[model samples]
Target: MEARLSKETVLKLSTDHKFGAEGNISTHKVEFIVDSDFGIPGAVTVVNGYDNEFFLESITIEQNFHFACKSWVQPKKLDPEKRIFFFNKAYLPCETPNGVKELRERDLMQLRGDGRGRRVCSDRVYDYDVYNDLGDPIMGDAYARPTLGGQHNPYPTRCRTGRPPSTTDSKTESRPSESELIYVPRDEELEDTKQETIDQGKLMAILRNIMPAIIDKIMGNEEVFDIDHYIKESGQSEFNSQLPLSRILLNLGGAVQEFFKFDPPKTYSRRRSHFLLDDEFGRQVLSAFPLSIESLKVFPPVSKLDPSIYGSVESALKEEHIIGHLEGMSIQQALEENKLFILDYHDVYLPFLERINGLEKRKAYATTTIFFLTKMGTLNPIAIQLALPTGNPNTSSKQVLTPPKDDTSKWLWQLGKAHLLHPHMRYTLKTNAISRQTLINAEGTIETDYTPGRYCMQFTSAAYKDWWRFDMEGIPADLVRRGLAVPDATEPHGIRLLIEDYPFAADGLLIWSSIEKLVRTYVNHYYKNSNAVSSDNELQCWYREFINLGHPDHENATWWPKLANPEDLISMLTTVIWTVSAQHAVLNFGQYPYGGYVPIRPPLIRKLIPKEEDPEYSDFVKDPQRYFLSSLPSLFQATKFMAVINIGSAHSPDEEYIGGRNDVTSWVGEPEIIDAFNQFSMEMKSIEMEIKRRNADPKLRNRCGVDVIPYDLLIPSSGRGATGRGVPNSVTA
Candidate 1:
């Protein structure tokens, strides 16, 4: 039999055997029939069947035969010359295939390189095939050999060759490309991107938190930006090292500045202590105390008490609780009663009195008078009358004074009367005993007197003289005698009487008497009847006979010269005419009359004296009475006094008057009356001064023991209008 060589066999022989001649017969040919499943037609070759055979030429194997070929009878090794042998299948008999018919050339051609055939070849070659069965290739018949140039397998020459046969039979699975296999870099790179976003968010948050703080810093309120330091310190940490601390702080500061740019400038106030001992007072007191003493020769004594106690005393003095003991009492009594009252031992009184006297230089006598009267309580009645303009009783009335029914009226009237009688009286009277009873009725059951303490009396030297000499020569005696002069019996020929005896004990008696006499005289002169005779019978007779009988118009009748002595009437009439003519002259000619009714008074006598030494005295000498009496006319002209007296058959008439006319017309024309009263006041004031001077004689002064210098007296003229603007002077008379 001839050996047939497959392509695999050839490849194996080529690889295993060399071309060197060893032992083979010449001109030998071997042929093998292969099944179609084995290979393609040209793929097989003929070769010695045994390993000992060799040939010099290419061997060929038949496409569909299975046979063996050898050159020697026994598979001998031939010399190198006999190695090439030819085995011709044509010489062998044509026989049918024994077991299974071999494939033909064309069929073998179809089987070449097929995965099924390759698999069969593997099975036939090896007892058990390691190659997988190829039931159906995954890539179907279009499978191509894998190429190494790309991603395909390089070893396998067919599509199904590299894959396991079962894999190929299952289903086609998609292989991933390079890009799909490469995953997103999720470790450090992704973390970095996420961290960057967080850092940006954190920066924005920090900026928002610190913006306000920066604004405050720029506004000069550094405390508001205290967090900036913290932020800087925080930024220095490793975690925040990259943060721009200075830039961020600057930005925040700028934002703050912009926010507060419109704010007003800050104001700073130096602290001050209200304590008087502080720096301000220390300097002031030191300078003032020394300078004041040097200038005025007066130093307020410093107390020996502790400063705290001195402070308390200062406070008490400021509050008026430490009034000098002499305020509401006679100087002698104040000196004696030191323990009963808080005294301003500071001796402020003399200086105050000097100040008051200085005011007199400025023609501020009214003000000075008011100050003294107020301190002494003598101003109370005037103050009360002013406050209740309608309630006060008539100043000229002799009737019992009746106060209003109201408690306030009663209290005020009593207080005013007490103050008037005794200017030093302090306690306000309480007529409502229930009020005092209530106090006594309190839980303590203590007994307390409703009346206040002992009353103090204050009187000017002039007042004392006038009051003491009432019966002897003052207004009381004058009024009691109905404008008559009386003799002083004690002085014998020293005084003469022009009128009968009249009692002048009580306060209102003199004023009332004067008012009555004036009313009687004027009414009698006008009505042609005796004003003093107002009995019902008398009035009836006069009314029927004189008034009702049209023949004699009694109501309009004038009795200018009938009732009074001609000389006295002429004198009175002359005084009135002179007063009117003087007024007319001043008004019309703008100058006073040169001489008329000049009295022989001291003021006038002083004016006539020649003063060569003092300028002020020279000026006074030129017109001393004029200087003193310049204000008197105006004062008297404004006087308004109320009177209660019998008139027209009634005990008292409702008629009010300016002077004496019962007609309302007279009341309406009060200015003239007031002017007359003011002039009279000036005369009275001159008289009062004379009286004081007379009483200050050596004899009287020796009798009084004390130096009887008149306490600066203020004789309030009746007609001068009230001081303190329109407020009635009587309000605090």
Candidate 2:
């Protein structure tokens, strides 16, 4: 005589009514009795789940007739008019008995009559009507049907069970008012959106050719480079007629190099440069770059451990045990002490630890260009080498200059180290606006002038926690001699994409001093303020308002609320900035304008028509900006899909898990969370389908000699999915 609610029933009810503290509807177990004459259920009492409020109002006879119920208790309290509506929709386990007699006879079930009340009562009465009869009795499965004017449901709805198929004509079907259909996107509107996207793609292709050429021309010169020169140069060239000024500077800087190129001293050899090109120097440069220890070859490597080992949260919690030394300290307090410890940790302890751990020696590159004022003149040496750093500068390597092997040279070197190590030295250097690039050569003599030579180096920003630190106010001579010191020319952490610093290099490139400013100005507005219909709409607004900033209406606009909170906003923007800058660093750090591609790959070249026949094909270029914007939806969509998978797997006990801590399903086990995740998946899938439909036109495919449909470029190609090279079976097919 007992029945359980199906999972489908719970999910639908939860979604439709809303749950938790914010929900509009509440559940109640109501007592009712079946009328012998009408074979209909009449409500006796209804109790609300939230406040235990009882409602005993009489229900209409017509509603009872519509419900076609025998004596039973309603699962939850509802309006007297909607009692039948709720009863018709709820699903019950099929094992329950029938009729009012069975409902009253349930006392046949044993009970601990005198025992303390159980925390949870499974015996609460509920009668789920599986059949709804309007004319004649008919059976229904799940979900109660409402009249045509009833509230719309998100679930897949069906017609009333006993009702015959509507004989309504096309005119009747078309009679619904515009407000009833307002949420649906019209076919014409969808088509226009599709066309707009294609137009953006077309415009991007044209700019691709124009933008990169502008960067190359500017970086190749020794003189001050200007975008105006290129604008004039482009006017004479018929192909560059419509190139936009704002578009060309999308890389943040109008040019890739920091300033007009300062050619490495001609005597420097390309092949034998032990400077920044050497293994040691490369390591030092990477050290200054913003990255976590996990990214930079962490200890107790993940590859060596079994996946099962990471399946539990214990392992993740254990990793944080290293911070146990500051058990009761506040985050700000820990940070202050951590900063001091980090300076020594990176310079001395890190090297010592690596040595003891049998790790290879890492090269140290000069952060600032070293200048030596000799009797000959001022010479800017790209790098310097250490000689007997612990005792005195006079004792060692032939590569480093040791004048007269006397106290004068040693004393002068020490004085220079002390001057360079002064905490505020970088502030003065910024005012001078000097810039230099990493040089890869071992040929030049390591040289520096003691008579106030310019050695400007910016420290890494504070956002790196304590990872990229320096002994700013300490004796550099001893540290350098020990091969544990970095040059003053080094840029701060997170400045990998120096393009942002180009416009304000003389202002000391302090734009990244606080991520909050950027988040408040750029990230927040796009996420929150704009009324975008989709991710495309949001991204377009972002580019127009923040990145371009050339649009007049957005000049004074403040705030965007794309994400839920400040934490999420910070996390998202941090990822975007770090991703963009890291790639830019790879290109501009050593060889300027090499690799010429944006970090994230753009959407595949769209072939809208035959290459030779299409008029726009001649000007068709690859616009990375458009492609980058387009690709963002895929990331968000994929994240949703992955969450859905995790949620689905969480419900299955048979599913094999990789690691204790690594299993996302373990972390996201709530039923509500799973339902929310599925809803997002449905939305994203709908958007993906729309995109597919737009791209499905035959003309979009390359239809030359051998027609080939383009593979989905937005999806990542994994080695695990490759056929020949450790690719998975899914990708190979």
Candidate 3:
């Protein structure tokens, strides 16, 4: 028979047995007994001697109310609260009960055994009440209700056979119906709970892996973060504010200087301001970079750099200049060397200096006159002229040489002569202050000495009114009028007389230097040689005729012997023809004050120079008639001419003549005339070429090279409808 054990005796035995083998036990198994009063299998609590629970296993209580027990030994001492209680019997009858037992009567179950010591012992009898009715009993809660719904018996229930409830007999009872259990949960509430669980998991993982440095920064750790310096250093404002002026100038000057180093470069250099006072040096620097000593001193001092050092730098700037530097001495030594200074001045310098006292005052007048003329003409003559008095040289009652009243008139006449005699003198007037002044003061007196080889020139004015007087009164009328002379009506009258000389004898020859010399001579002779008061129109006429005829071949004729060759004659003739034609056009069609009309005729000698009467000669002369006619239609149809000839047949006879009301047809109807002229000019050009070719061929004319095309035949026609009335064809080599 099994021994009957009270609950107190069982509890005491469990405690004593567990403590006695505490160190010896390597492994232990615990079991629990079911309490019929609680409808649960009561479990044994495995604990240390100090009453610290370690584990629990379930056993069973029989219908007679005896305790069944099991035991466990801990590997290490556990916390009293963490121990688990296990029931040795299945809770449900449907569950298999492999280890179910009655807790009241049992043999001494071996709870723990020492593997190392080879020790085995029957030890603790587990207290079943600890698992069944102790504080917070395992497997018992309000949420968990039994599936077997009826009130359970306080003592162990009988098995299905009405025998003692053993492990096999307990499973034999009819299993509780599955429908007896119930559960209720809100779907939405469950989903929210699940989402919160996932979020918490992610947050914990992130926090665990984050670097301490980054975490501290995010967490407002003052020692790890900085913002003040970063904000201040983020923009361009500070960089822009500190830019220096000297650096800008350096960049600009460097750019300009580099640009000037190229051949055929810009007229102005980058360092133009720095070199402003040195005209020659500026030009040299612009052209080649480093300037020679001779060129350097011309400019005023703007820097403290020694001239020699500057020269060295300048020389290095130009590849060619370097060679020159090397030829003298080492480049360094040459740069340092100082030679005797020779103050060289351009004609512009003196005039510039004169206005220094009051630059504005001088700039107002001197700049417009002297500077302008210097640029237009040459510097020497303008300087001399500007230096001269504004009045006449008085010698006696019979001799008074007055300064020229019509400067432009004299200049234009000289210009015309120059164009006629020396067509190669095509120098453009410089547009400096002096030239501007000359242009502005174009009406001023232009006195010149009379000489054989001088006459052709032009001048500027210092003011608009002066320019007007020259343009309106002097240029197209008195000075350029063909075969006519008109004296200046204003104060300080001066005469302009042309002379026939070698080169100057040619039509269209332009000898600019000769023109200048002639004007100079006129000034000198009138003041020194001639009795200025003599109003000998014959002498004037003789001079005019001599000029009009160009140079003569007659020996001892006043200007005949001066011509060097027949080539000179052709050149002069060409120049004269061009000048006269230009003048005629200006006077007849241009806006001159005289209503585009001038009372002038062709030179009598020009008219009287008898043309060949032969039909062949006339044909040759008229060969450009086709071209002339062809050009006329367009010329006459122009709006300007139409405006000029707007008056109709009802107008007065004088007006009618001017307005194209004679029996003659309108200019637009004269195509045939222009065609004839064009054909004639073409033929004339052909003939001219043939003559030149013949002259050039030594085999044809003993190499004498005489121009046989008659001067009169070469002259352009004056009549509107005539052949070859305008510009002739150009000659080419």
Best by TM-score: 2
**TM-score of model 2 (CA atoms):** 0.18
**How far does residue 222 in candidate 3 sit from its true spot (Å)?**
65
- What's the alpha carbon RMSD for model 3? 58.8
lDDT of 3: 0.23
Predicted candidate 2 versus true structure: per-residue lDDT over 63-133, tens digit per residue: 33223222222234321222221222111223222533333233322211222232122222211111111
* Model 2 ranges off by over 4 Å: 1-369, 372-379, 388-518, 521-733
2 against 3, candidate with superior TM-score: 2
What would the per-residue lDDT of candidate 3 be over residues 236-272, giving only the tens digit for each residue? 2222324488866665665443332211111122332
Q: Which of the predicted structures, 1 or 3, would earn the higher lDDT when compared with the native?
A: 1
- TM-scores for candidates 1 onward, in order: 0.16, 0.18, 0.15
Ranking by TM-score: 2, 1, 3
